[model samples]
Target: MTISLHRSATVLFQGDSITDVGRLVEPDSPLGNGYVRMAAERVLTALPDAGITFVNRGVAGDGVSDLRARWREDALDIQPDVVSVLIGVNDTWRRYCSGVVTSVRAYENDYRTMLAQVRDELDAQLILIEPFLVPVQDEQWAWREDLDPRIQVVRRLAEEFDAELLAADGLLNQAARAVGGAELITGDGVHPTPLGHTVLAEAWTELAGL
Candidate 1:
């Protein structure tokens, strides 16, 4: 899919901690230190003359439901040309760690609602990224049961909404092979190490046609 960039474009990224990557949230530099930053850097270099505004509104530990609650302020208010959403990990993580269950139905419903809002409010293009879990440790493998369903939900939504889907699950898994299959991109199996973010950044740029 080719995402045609206009001379002056505004792009907004929304997601959880992996996306957050310790952004200051202050005015000077809010792009953070993860894939979002890497993606933005590539975009800037690719379109040096273009006036592209990049906004990162990723909050650590946020799920689909949280995104819905803050959609107005973080997303709608930005009124971006392309809105990239990478979410759903927390929905799966909370279940295993805290026994807080957010059913697949609930996950899909909330995600669909947020997409609808973006469609209606901004009429912006969508980039949907899948949530992934690489079992670097033995215990983390069990998370697949919960996370797989959510990944499918995101894929289904991407098709339904006519959005571009970044299959991060497959990309990250494939990336692990490069970094020694026994080792992981994330120490905890959730967050991405710098190497993991590089893989994601490259994949994201390719997906966005940057």
Candidate 2:
């Protein structure tokens, strides 16, 4: 299957650190170092004549609110045909480590609002990637109670927005269990290793049919 949004279109990626793996911060270099870069590379290689432009506007530690704040400047201004987003890990992580409690209700509300803007205002194809954690440490396992609900919210939002859903969480967990465990994928419980990112990119590609 082909991802038929718009022909020869520009695709914009938005989210937190996982997405913002050090994008050049210059127009000359837009693809970051994580799944975004890998996905772009695959698209270029597979569809060399498609002439799609890929851009990453993910900030290292952004939450749903942060993405909302920069939506116009980073995303809307670009007027992309497809907008892919992976967020909510920081929202859950902050509650665990920084006493910043982003309740499930609040997370869902903010995330829905952001997606609505993309759907109504920009008229773009939306791809919502589920936030993931591999449980490398004890504390990471506890994060499930908080993170799982947010992941559910993303699924609901995807349905509401008629968007594509990329189940990165399940894919990574299965990959980890198939190999060794969470440690091999994510050294900590959050950030992914190079191999982990590659897994994510491949999963996204397969799910998006790109």
Candidate 1 backbone overlaps, count: 0
| Candidate 1, 1-210: lDDT as tens digits | 756667789999999999888895645559989999999999999999999889999999898899899999999998999999999989999999999999999999999999999888888989999998877889889999999999999999999999999999988887887778625687678888888898889988897676
Error in Å for residue 77 of model 1: 1.2
What local distance difference test score does each model get? Answer: 0.89, 0.86
Shift in Å, residue 123, candidate 2: 1.5
lDDT tens digits by residue: candidate 2, 115-154? 8878788888888999988888776788999999999999
Measured on C-alpha atoms, candidate 1 has an lDDT of 0.89
TM-score of decoy 1: 0.96
What is the Cα-based lDDT of residue 195 in candidate 2? 85
Clashes of each: 0, 0
> Candidate 1 at residue 117, lDDT?
90
Candidate 2: 10-residue stretch with minimal lDDT? 1-10
